[model samples]
Target: MAGAQTYESTRARVEQYFDRTATRTWERLTSDAPVSGIRATVRAGRDRMRDLMLAQLPQDLTGARILDAGCGTGALAVALAARGADVVAIDISPALIDIARRRQPEGLPGRIEFRAGDMLTPELGHFDHAMAMDSMIYYGAADIAGCLGRLAPRLAESFVFTLAPRTPLLMAMWRVGQVFPRADRSPTMVPHSVKGIARAMRRAEVQGNLRQIERVNSGFYISSALEFRP
Candidate 1:
C-alpha cells in the first residue's frame, strides 16, 4: 500500500500532465498517415489495442451508459457514442477534454458528454461500463483498490482497464516517486505487477479475465476487462 495525494491535488497534477502530453498524443492519434515505417507499424498496433477493447463490449450499445475514466483524447468515448452508447468521458485535464470536444462530431446521432473531474471522486454518475486505459498505473495498491471499490457499484455491467507490466525496476521507480512525484527533468508512471493488480482487484471484490495482447508491433500490453452484475 502507498499513500496518495487527495483527489483534488492528484487531479491537478494529472491535468498538468495532460496539458504537457496531449498535443503529442493527439498528433500521434489523429495523423492521416504515418511518416515512417515505424510509424506505419505502430498504427496497426494502436488499432489493435482499440479493437481488443471494443470486442469485449456488449453487442448492443444503444442506451448503454458508459464512463471513460481518464479518457485521454476521448477517442474511445467518441467511438462508443457513435455506436449509440450514452457516453460520459471524464478526464483530469480540461485542456485535453477541450481538444477532444473540438475533435468530436458536431452532429453525431448519439450524445457524448465530457467531464473534467477526479477519478477517486463519487460525484461522477453511474454507468453500464467504465474504462480506465493506460492511466491505471497512476495509483498504488491502496489507492487502486479504493478507486475500484468506488467504481464497482457505479458500473452497472462491466469495467475495463489497461495496465503496463510491473517489472521490479518499475516498482522501484514508483517507490522512489513517493518522495518526488513530479521530480527532475522527467516524469515516470507507476506500473503494477500482474500479481499485485490481481490481488488488489480481488480484494476489491471485482472479478475479471486478464489477457495479453501482442500488437502488430513487437510491444505487448496487458488488459483486464471485468464483467460485473448487480
Candidate 2:
C-alpha cells in the first residue's frame, strides 16, 4: 500500500493548502462578484467548468445514488441533491468539509452525507454514478488507476472526473508556473497527459471518452472531462 500512503501524504498537503485558503477559495467558487485579475478569471472559468460537468450528468437523477468523490465545499453535492440525487460526498480536507456541512442548503429533494475521508479509501455503498471534479489533479498516473480500480466496482453506471491536460503547450505552461509560484498552489498538483489518463482508465478496466476543455487566459487547455462506463 505504498501508493496509498503516497496518496495520503498528497492529500494531507492538499488539505493544508485548502485549509489555509478556504475562505478565499470558497468565495472564488461561490461568488459572482466583479473581481479584477487573472486569478479571478481563472476562478470564474473553474466555476463554468463545474456547470459543464453537472450538465453532463443524467437528466433525471430522481432516487439515484451518486458518489461525489473529493467533494470540495459541497457545491456539486448541493447541486446533485437539488436535482433529486442522494449524494455521498467525501473529502480529505477537514476545513473544507466543515464549510460544506455548514453551508449546506436548507431543502432538497435528495439527502447528502458529508464525510471527511480520503476518496482513495471510503466505505462507500453502491452508487448509480460517481464524479470527481478537479480533485484528481493531485494524483499521478498510478494513483489515478488505483483509485479508478477501486471505485469502478462500486458504481453501477458511470464515472466522470477531470484531469490536467498533458499537452506540450500546457506542460510548458506548467513548467513556467513553477518559476512564479503562488501561495495557493498545491505542490501535489500533477498534470497528466491524455494518453496517460486513458492508459490509467484502461488499467482500471473502465472505458471512456475525453474532450479538451478550453483554457481561459491560461496557455493550455485547463482540464478534460473523462466520462467512463465500468
Candidate 3:
C-alpha cells in the first residue's frame, strides 16, 4: 500500500480535479442533455458498469445497508435505495454531492444519506456491501489497496470496485498525460493489472480474494470491476 504522503498527494489532486476542473463537465455528462459522441459512449459505458455492480448484490435489498462510495450524482445510490437498501452515498466533491442530493427523488423505498468526504472514512460506519464504482481509477495499485484495506474492515460481505485496466492503449495515454502542465492536467487514470493489485493487497490485511471481474469498453470509457470478498 502507498505511504501516507503519496496516497494523500494523489487524493488531493483528485479532489481538485473533480471539485473544480471537471465539475461542470461531470454535471453535464451525468445529465440527459445531449453530449458529443465520445461522451455519449462514456455515459453508456458508465451505465453498463453500474448495472454490472448491481448484478453482484442481492436483488431484494430490503434490510441491507450499502455504501455507495464515490456515489457521483447518486445514480447508483438512488437505484440501490429504490430496491430497499439503505444507502450512504459519499463523494469527495461537495458540488457533486449537491447535485446528487438535488437529483434524488422523494420517498424512496430506502433512505439515502448523502455526504461529501473521502469514501474510506471510518465514521461512515459499516455496511453489508459497498461499491466504489469508477472511484479508484486514478490511484496507484498500492494506494487503491490501501483504500480497500481501510474500507474492508467496515464491510461485512463484499466490496465491489473498478480499476482502469492495464492495456497498451491506456498505457500510452498514461504516458501522454504525464507530459501535460500540472495545472492544466486532470488527475491521471492509472491503469492496473489484477495480478499487481493482488500483490499490493498482500501487504495489507484486506482478508479477501477477488471473486469476480468484468470489463466494459465503450469508445472513450474503459473500466474493469473486481469484487473482493472475505
Highest-scoring model, TM-score: 3
Compare the candidates by lDDT and give the number of the best one. 3
Ranking by TM-score: 3, 2, 1
Q: For model 2, how does the per-residue alpha-carbon lDDT over 182-229 read when each residue is reduced to its tens digit?
A: 866655357787677667666656544544444323322266777666
Report the C-alpha lDDT of model 1 over 1-230, residue by residue, as the tens digit: 13356434545555676677555755565456454565555455556666667777875699888888877777788778877888888877777777788788876656888877776567777888887766665556656665666777677776766655566655676678767655332335667555676687677665554344422222333333333333
**How many residue pairs in model 2 have overlapping backbones?**
0
Backbone clashes per model, in order? 0, 0, 0
Give the alpha carbon lDDT tens digit for every residue of 189-220 in model 3.
Answer: 99998888888888765667774478999999
Compared with the true structure, all predictions reach lDDT values of: 0.64, 0.75, 0.89
Winner on TM-score between 1 and 2 is 2
> What TM-score does candidate 2 get on C-alpha atoms?
0.83
- Least accurate stretch of 10 residues (summed lDDT) in model 1? 214-223
Better of 2 and 3 by lDDT: 3
